[model samples]
Target: MSPATSLTRNQKLAALAFVLGVALVYYASHPLLLCRQLIIRDDEALYARLHLGNDLPYAWLTESDYSFRLAEALLQGKLGLTEPPPEWVNETIPLRGRYYSVFPLGSVLTMLPFALAHRLIAFSPSGAAIALIGALATFLFLRFALRCGRNFRDAVWLTLFSTLGTWLWTNTAMGGAWQLALGFAMTGELAA
Candidate 1:
């Protein structure tokens, strides 16, 4: 392949790497220290809630906090792979009902593997991993957008702007991984 073709392949691989790394890091850095009930923050709470009660595997899955719930679901089986519930109801997985109807369903679908992996290891760990992954996706999406414009110089300028002046940086700093990913995805989509 020519240099241009090789460069394109690398960029594609970078995108894949970014997505996978986000999922893995989220899994590894997950707060293994905290208990499910003690997690009070809205986002964290949502994940904690999913695996609660008789719901067990699907405890945290809910409609109100769809994206985070979806993230949690994605991390279910990778680590230890939680034992299958005596009965599995697809609906119990949380975030499946209303979310699957309106949105593109891409994000929700992308989340399943990680959720399964984390569910296997432990619920909280999976949640933390998913959150980190979402944040990483947001950051990388922004970086990709900046780099794809004009040339390297223009890419640098855009990156600086996104880092300093945009919500991209703020969302990540605030630990709003979903927001980061949403903003990046929306901005890119709109731009396109």
Candidate 2:
């Protein structure tokens, strides 16, 4: 049998907690790593808000930018864009001569505060939000693993496999609002 399988329950619990701490640190920093890789597009600059390397960190002329736009609109006490969308924006429905995002409202709400506090989040609010939700998912996963009473080695392996082996990493790597909602939903799944 492996040495880990022979540890006392308290030892196992302590080790699991330490592993969780390390996992949290990793999730917290994951976004910064992702952000550094972003190449900002000149057109995306106006709404880029926070600039890492002063670059556009999002997709242009795509539905991916909808949440950011929705957030900007919500800040103005409306759900639809006040002015015409640029030719690049998509996945929106036209209503009452205004354009609204076709994506879930959850994304718009998630981006609202960041849009509202555009000056405070250091130009990467979307990334920061993704990071926060990712960390929460990590915490939930660790808790779930611990509650299952798996051995220390098994627990660590599970967390690593889930984080690296799954598309979870891919979703969090981008700053899209859909990705954020997906990550948040995954966090909810972890809690269940």
Candidate 3:
């Protein structure tokens, strides 16, 4: 009932909607976001070839930074947040190659950690594990959207817009098809 609260109530929700819309642009691209930390440590060709080759022991080690290689070799099966690189490489973010040139480079990076995962978990559950991660991300997104406003109908519409918007769909087509799906799901919630 205070003057400030009244003023806030008077403001159009359009601003909130616009912010959510712009946020949807970024959210539609979440899968690409998670991979940035890893990508910062390695080049495009090295990681792509490693992934395409199925994360072979020697190949992964050679493509990965020294610390990442050492840790992956030692603990190939653990599941948790990875440690940052102990050292830096110049021009670490490569801009060349098919995946990088086309997609935003996030999908590749997001897949990077899983390369070493083969050494740890049973191969049978890997697909399931990745799916679980995607589902969890989607859940988090829904929670965030609910917190943004009380209008359930409005939130649902926004969710659809953010999840299936052009930015995400186009980017997904460019590269990282799987990541695009997961990322759009997570971001859609936030955008809603």
lDDT of 2 by residue, 9-90 (tens): 8866776665555444444444443334344333345345464342543443223557877888888788799788865565
Q: Pick the candidate with the highest TM-score.
A: 2
| Residue range with the least summed lDDT across 10 consecutive positions in model 2 | 54-63
List lDDT for all candidates, in order: 0.43, 0.64, 0.38
Worst 10 residues of 3 by lDDT: 91-100
Per-residue lDDT of candidate 3, residues 47-89 (tens digit): 5744656433332223222222333333444332234322322
Stretches of model 2 off by over 4 angstroms after superposition: 1-63
The reply for model 3, stretches above 4 Å from the true place, is 1-112, 120-137, 173-192
Q: What is the lDDT of residue 6 in candidate 3?
A: 31
Model 1 clash number: 29
Compose the digit string of candidate 1's lDDT tens values, residues 59-134.
2232222344545544542221133322322332324232222334564554455456655665542345345544
lDDT of 2: 0.64
- Lowest lDDT block of 10, candidate 1: 77-86
TM-score of each: 0.35, 0.66, 0.30
Cα error, candidate 1, residue 68 (Å): 3.2
TM-score winner between 1 and 2, please give it: 2
